[model samples]
Target: METSLLAFLLISLAKVIVVVVILLMAVAYTVLLERKLVGRIQNRWGPSRVGPFGLLQPLMDGAKLFLKEDLIPEAVYRPLYILAPIIALGCALMSIAVVPFGADIRWKGVDLFEIADVNIGLLIILGITSVGVYGIALSGWSSNNKYSLLGALRASAQVISYELALGLSLVGVVLRSGSLRLRDIVDVQSTHGLLSWNFFGGFQFVAFLIYLMAAYAETNRAPFDLPEAESELTAGYHTEYSSMKFAMFFMAEYGNMITVGCVATLLFFGGWTSPFGNLFPEPHNAILLSFLSLFWFVAKVFCFLFLYIWVRGTLPRFRYDQLMGFGWKFLIPVAVANIVVTSFFIGLRLPLH
Candidate 1:
């Protein structure tokens, strides 16, 4: 029993390290992806000089941010101001703990792919993500700046409004799958091909759409990114933050994006399931299957990330009123209606298959 406990502890620590490294790399390349995408949208060159088509641009940016002097504005709540970003980034990193990167691969008679296979994986993710809103609110209030305060207020309002719809949108999925376990959700998708997937059904499809839109808003992505609207808020709640502190918030945003993408992939795009499962039946080739699963998962996530950058380049920011109205009036109602319809259809037991 003691040896088992020690093994679990060591495995947990290793998982944390791997997740942190992956998140750091993902954040770095997310910036690169954004710059290149936005440049293409605007008919201009993005970063081309930094290490072969700007591959190393994120690295340079990181180095620059590290070398810059840390700044703390006068009259700020020093403790809260410093703590907010850490909370945000920490919560963001924590969500990845339950994400199954690939199917289990046995090595030395032990499964080595995922970290912890918690039964309440979905709940864990939702709870951790919900807590992230505090980081935004606290950062703004701690800054003691009017603009930062406004940004914080906007962020809080946005998160609250969208979270309702987001949660509702996911209800259809949870109900259909009959389990809140992340692995179980993935299993449902794997058994049902793309067409039979939750998002492919009529009511659930609509629900998925609502979820996607709400997710963008929830993450404060472009168009819905009024919280950090540079044209108005001057860098939003983190305007007063500098050095590693500001970087924490930046990292949190990207990490949240990856989290959102992973959830969507798992919930709708079949998790780590291959696209054409009909063609391939065997799941026993552990290493090969793991690679395929990881590849599919990453591909789906990258597509969503690209969509995020594309929207940022192509769309204009929403007016504050319009943003709120869209959430409360349109998204909320549609999401609720989708749930109702899904429930009715599910009760009828129609030939949904």
Candidate 2:
């Protein structure tokens, strides 16, 4: 028993370290990705001098942010001001703890896909994400700046409004899968092809659309990014933050974007499952299967992330009232109706999975 406990502890530590390192690297590059994609959308060169195709731009940006002078306003609440970004960044990373990767791998009898396997992983992720709002609110309030406070209030309110729709959007999938375990939800779509998957096959397209719209608002992306509208908020809640502290806010944003994409892939899309399942048989070896599934999972996530940047570059930001009304009037009702329809099919015993 002692040996097993030791092994488990060590494995957990390793997983945490691995997740943080990879998450930060991915978040950094996501910044570069948004820049490059937006530049193309605008017909302009983006980060040409940083590196080849601006690949090293994230590294350069990180260095620059760190080297810049850290500043604090004497009028601001120092304790809360300092704690806000840490809370924001920490909660963002915390949500990733329960998220399983594209494929489960084993090392010395230890599964390395996730840090935790709680039965209510989905709830845990959402709960942690909600806590992130506090960080934003605190950052803005403590900054002792009017624009920062306004940005925080707007962003937090939008998040709360959309969160209802976001939660409701998943009810259909949960009803069909009959499980809150994210892995189980993914497994339900495994035996099916693209058309039979949850988003397309289960006739839950309406739920998918609601989730997509709510996700954009939840992450403060364009059309819903009114909180940080440059023309109005002057960089929003993080306006008073400088150097690494300011960098943390952006890191949190990008990290949340990745998390949102990952969740969307696993919940709505046939995560890690190949479109032509029969054509690509699972490898006889466990290691090989892990890598192959990893590829498919990453590919699906890439598409979702691309969609994020594409919409950001294309859509105009919604007016604050429009954003709120859309969430409360349209998204919430559609999500509720989608749930009703899903329950009807479930009652009729449609073999959705």
TM of each candidate vs. truth: 0.95, 0.96
Worst 10 residues of 1 by lDDT: 104-113
Query: How far in Å is the alpha carbon of 69 misplaced in model 2?
Result: 0.7
Reference-based lDDT, residue 97, model 2: 89
TM-score of decoy 2: 0.96
Error of 1 at 180 (Å): 0.3
Candidate closest to the true structure, highest lDDT: 2
lDDT of 2 by residue, 216-249 (tens): 9988989899889999999999999999999999
Candidate 1 residue pairs in backbone clash? none
CA-lDDT, candidates in order? 0.86, 0.89
Local accuracy of candidate 1 as per-residue lDDT tens digits, 148-215: 99999999999999999998999888888888988888888776467556667323778778888998
List, in order, the clash count of every candidate structure.
Answer: 0, 0
Q: After TM-score superposition, what is the CA distance of residue 137 in candidate 1 from its true location, in Å?
A: 0.9
RMSD of 1: 2.5
